[model samples]
Target: MTGNTHIVGGIAASLAFAQISNDNPVLLVGAGVIGALIPDICHGGSIIGRKFSIVSKVVTGVFGHRSFTHSLVFLFLIGALLHTLLTNDSIIAGILVGMVSHFILDMATKNGIKLLFPLKITVRFPITTRTGGAVENLVFAALSLLSVYFGYEAFAGYF
Candidate 1:
């Protein structure tokens, strides 16, 4: 999936999770965006990868795209790290949800993702689409709208 789609999915996931965490919506959503983009750090051309080109190159050079970074192991490790480093559990939960959303979204792609990693197992949904194809664009739009609705609902009590 494209970074935009991943970001929107992250926002939607974080907003939906807001019903439970009820933390700062803005902070959760921001963490969600960062979480969404973090997995793509292996792809040098990806948004997060471009920002950290050297790291991207090193990761991609060693593991390749949709390999280690896309794995559940990576997600768990990152979540653990975040939980230890971040004082707010809500933010950690939001970030983990966002990263999980990224993994789920990637599972809908044709190439799929190595969910297990180091185990040479690629996991995907029954239905799949090209990375940045029309279907992905539609998914992006739908997720974006969902994010808006969920965001509004999550923050409604504040306003």
Candidate 2:
């Protein structure tokens, strides 16, 4: 999926997290966006990868795109690391949800990810689309609007 779609998914996941958690919505959602893009860091053309080319290159060289980074092991380790480092459980939850959202979005693509890793099991939905294609764009738009609605609902009383 495109970065735009991943970002939307991330935001939506964070907002969803907010519905149950009392963390600062703004910080949680922001971290969600970052987490969503973190998986794609293995791709040289990814937004985060472009910003950190050396790290991206090294990761890609070692594991290749959509391999280790897209796996459950990576997600668990990252979540554990973040949880250990961050004091707020909500932030850790938001980031983990965001990263999971990324994985969910990628599962809708033709080239699925190795979710189990080491086992080489590629998981994908029967209904899939090309990356950045018309379907992906539609998904992105719908998710964007959903995120906005969720945000409004999340902070409705603030306004």
* Full-model lDDT, candidate 1: 0.90
Per-residue accuracy of model 2 over 97-133 as CA lDDT, tens digit each: 8899999999999999999987788899999999979
Candidate 1 lDDT tens digits, 24-134: 888888888888889999999999999999999999999999989999899989988987788987678778888999999999998899999988988999999998899
- lDDT against the true structure, per candidate, is 0.90, 0.91
Candidate 1: segments with Cα more than 4 A from true spot:
none
Clashes of each: 0, 0
TM-score of each: 0.96, 0.96
TM-score of structure candidate 1: 0.96
lDDT of 2: 0.91
